[model samples]
Target chain A: MLALELGPVKGSAVLPTSSASGENAFRALFAAHYPFIWRQMRRLGVPESAVDDATQEVFIVAARRMSDIQPGAERSFLFGVARRVAADARRTRHARASAVSEPLGADTADEREDPEQALQGRRSQAMLHRVLDAMADDTREAFVLFELEELSRREIAELLGIPEGTAASRLRRAREEFMEIAGRMKATASRGAP
Target chain B: MKRLKDELPEESFEASLLAADAGGEPPEGPRRRALDAALRVVALGGGSALVAGKAAAAATAGAAATGGGGAAGATGAALAGWKILAVVAIVGGAAVGGAVAVTRTTDVAPSESATSSPSAPVPLARPEPAPPDTQSAAPPPMLAAPAPAPIHVDTPKVAVPSVPSTVPSSAPVFDLAGEVRAIDRARAALAGRDTGETLAALDDYDRRYPAGSLAREAAVLRVEALALRGDHAEAARRAQELLAASPEGPYRARLRKVIDGAAASSP
Candidate 1:
């Protein structure tokens, strides 16, 4: 079968020692940070239809710069890349309302059991993006790291390379803005603004 | 890092929205594509290292200020087709030599096809073009779609190439070389025009590295082998199935060629 013991990538003149290890590092980095990058793109105003492409753009940058990324700072480097990708996507793109493109064949029993809940989840997710999109990007980054990704305040500060006080204050401001915008959105939706 | 629900007294509108946000799972399809693209970059010996340096600096600078435009174009332009194929060929070459050395020492059977075949190895080399009706009339209903299906999806459950459980979701092992070797073995076999051997290499690849990073490459090679063996219809169907599943898949151009070639050659 495909399983074979992988020796060091030896005797490859085309692949320098640095790049071989870089490739290995790149794989591990991709595995670890892909979800974060994907979520960051979606939350940072990359429309749903474009999230995948955006995520690819982020990782492609990371892959190319694998050597420069310090061991502990991979997340920070990836976040930096993701921000630019999200920005680029938001700039050039038209708003395309995301369709429920769930893989029909792979629906788990849990998803099949509660279709309405699933739909509700989708709605809430869309709403959350709207509320987030209304916020400034810096505030949204702090909010995403803390609220959704569940990173500690110190970690968020480190990832964004800001003081803890700055990160916490940004998160606080983000929460206040979030509640305000979310309330307004609810009122508008209830009034049938669509 | 307490979730909003922990701080809030009750589940408010915003809290519910946050809850929904947490439930939103990132799709695996895109992740797989991203990985393939990244691996392609890595396999190219970090060809864009210089370009990425500039992009990274600009990205950081832009994040601090107003975001910059025009940074995305450089990396997109770097992903030319010949570079990718060169990476594949070089890595696959190294793998072929390595696999032979490892095969002698390892107890794993060299001929995976000698064991029970996963999908019956269709006698693709038959000279008589199997009547179209007869081919379609066969039992398993693979590729029932007028529209292409997703790459890792097996809707019919029977005919579709069994979507290996290891496609995505799990963190990939740091065996980029192993992935290259496994899929390259199949590529090498196909180079020899040994259809049976190519299919066997693929089966072995499927069995061993189900989650191997090069699963899509292996899938593409499988379609090519089928086509090479004169199983044009089967090749076309499988290519169509994979294309449907991953419209923007890595080997899209090659898969399109397989489908078009199959159509042109088939009765």
Candidate 2:
């Protein structure tokens, strides 16, 4: 006879046979993917504050659709939900930057390795932020989800409801635009350097 | 774009790329709390769907009983049952589809303080500590006491009648299933660090069933709620009471962590 492993199972151990069990499974799945869903929402152009609303909306859909989701496709399903939630948030003009850009005071800079490098880092970040701000919504989203989010073209296509080839092309166009903007900012900074 | 990507050292870009892939860290401060609250809403929707489905099923069964035809009625009833199932499936399916569509088009930016005001106040409660000895064979201290059962503060009086004595003449009545669900909801809310909904649910439970057997558990949860709301003084007092009431409570360690975390984060 085969021996069963004594350790606790990770992921969904109970089948969603009943509506209640299905709901529980859905909650477990959402909790497990909370960070991923949040990140995807951010990259898609959701603002930091509204990310919660978007995330909640995504899970609400997941709960309702628990029966339709394939047993093994929970992660992909969530990403799908996240993509839709992010899109809805975008429509409402609720997309915002994450909180990392909050201006830290000079006193908080005590741990820097070198002041010059730190200052340069801030400048570069500012320039990058500006460039990101200027990109069209689709191009920006494609680039962020592809490059920053590291999602494959196929995944991006599914999430955005576009063809894989379209996702790749959009990513390329976005990268080109981002580079052109960044180049101008860098040259301008070099010329003005003391 | 190439130059910009190159301008930053590969390491920093790589770090950011990794963080982005990991969805970055949880939003800090109020944003994090808000996100947590949103997640609880999602979890609640899941529970709600189940309830709705059950209601739909019951309605369909009642409809079947009223109209009995020959063999045709049996076939019609079967078809109706299938139709009900289909409707449930479609509603749930559409919800998931909607969520995906929303996530795709949204542009995530940090909201201006003005726009984000409504979402910030929602996640104020912390999670309640789990009962001690949940994992081990040892029963919880409350279970051993054999004392008078506490009244459920939240339940309707008609649904759950009051017991004449602390030790009821009948068997000990415990809604283990509902308690389990409440516990799960509480934990989910806590994990998101959403204090508002967490506290609301706890308070709702208290009102619905005034003398709940889990009153001590709810009291322990109150401390976490106070802590999350930045009421450290109140949190400490409640934590002390919890410890005093159940010195060997399983959740002592976790409660201490909550206290420490609250202290560290205090301005």
Candidate 3:
């Protein structure tokens, strides 16, 4: 019977000097961080349809820098990649937007087990994205890292390379803006409710 | 964590962030695409580690901020066809190669050689159907997807009753150099801007070694050649077909690139 056969590829330049172990580490990192990175990219404003590419982009960076990702900091490295990829995407969308005659596939819109719950979920996510998009870039980064990601303020500061106090202040501003938007959304919903 | 009150049960911050996407599970295509892309990067010997993560963070952010209006097509432009092809090729090769090595070790060292045919050297991680409950222990997000089906061919199972094994002795190891030579010749034709020559070279390569290792690279070249010949209609249609077939395949990105470039440059 005809079967596809495969075997060890040697002398290939892609094989890093410390490949076996490095590859294992890379695979582990990919598994653990993929979903989180996917979500983070979406939250950071990569279109949902493009999240897979963005996630791959992050890991693509990671694979190249396997040795450089300090053991405990894979998340940080990945989040950072998501951040850059998202920013780049945003610029692209703004640039050739006129040229983009059609909206992208966006996130998959599969019917969920619970239709109402899914509707609510979509609304919340839409609002959340709106709120985040409205916030200043630095403030959004701080808020996302500190609150959504549950990283400590100190960690946010370290991650964003801002001072502890600067991170703290951005968090404060982000929260205020978030609540302001939330209040407005609630008011709109209530007005429509009666 | 409470960014907004009354947000837990009905409007879970996490669920909104981490719900099962509308797509259900991650589509099977991109993993292969991603793997292919990664391999291409490795193949290019381009300082494999992603542009020094630390440096990339700083440099990319600054570049984006300044790139402004012109930064629109930066992504497709940044990763040229060859670089992407190289990365995906490496990852694809690695997956196939890893499976072979693993199977070889298992076959030679073990006693029950009857499980898989001696002649039918198994592909990487042949997947046995895992027990249903076995995967229950994993977290919800963990189930987004498993490794590419090809990579998981690790488990020896009934090799599909097929036509027969026609692989040559050296077929086990992919002839990457030869693959590279083929790609280089096509690329040369492409560079020389001889659309007919480029198309001919790509077609000849595909016909000669239908299952040769660099099949995707050949596809990328074909799509690119079609575009160069201003056969944008056929190019786009072919690319879309290939994309639907392998959405996450490494060649998809370059295929998309050629399609996008044609669109952008056209009236």
Best by lDDT: 1
Report the lDDT tens digits of candidate 1 across residue range B1-267.
Answer: 566767875546666778777535578765775676565545443322222333343334323321222222233233222111111122222122121110011122212211111122221111123312232212111111001111111223322112322223231222333344455456556555577988998998788766544455677678878877888899889999877766644345556766877777867
Top candidate by TM-score: 1
Query: What is the Å distance of residue A167 in model 2 from its true position?
Result: 2.4
Model 3 chain B worst lDDT window (10 residues): B138-147
Give fnat (model 1).
0.24
Compose the digit string of candidate 3's lDDT tens values, residues B36-134.
Answer: 444332323222322233223323432342223122123313322211112222222221112111000121211111111111211101112332122
In model 2, state the lDDT of residue B122. 17
Q: Per-prediction DockQ, in order?
A: 0.13, 0.06, 0.05
* lDDT measured at residue A162 in model 1 versus the true structure, 0 to 100: 69
lDDT of 1 at B244: 77
TM-score of chain B of 2: 0.35
lDDT (10s digit) by residue, model 2, range A11-98: 2222113333433444455545566666667566665445655665554444434433322234445566565455555544422224
| Residue pairs with clashing backbones, model 1 | A1-B204, A2-B204, B148-B244, B149-B244, B149-B245, B150-B245, B151-B245
User: How good is the docking of model 1, as DockQ?
Assistant: 0.13
Model 2 bad stretches (over 4 Å):
A1-19, A67-77, A80-129, A185-194, B1-23, B27-267
TM-score of 3: 0.43
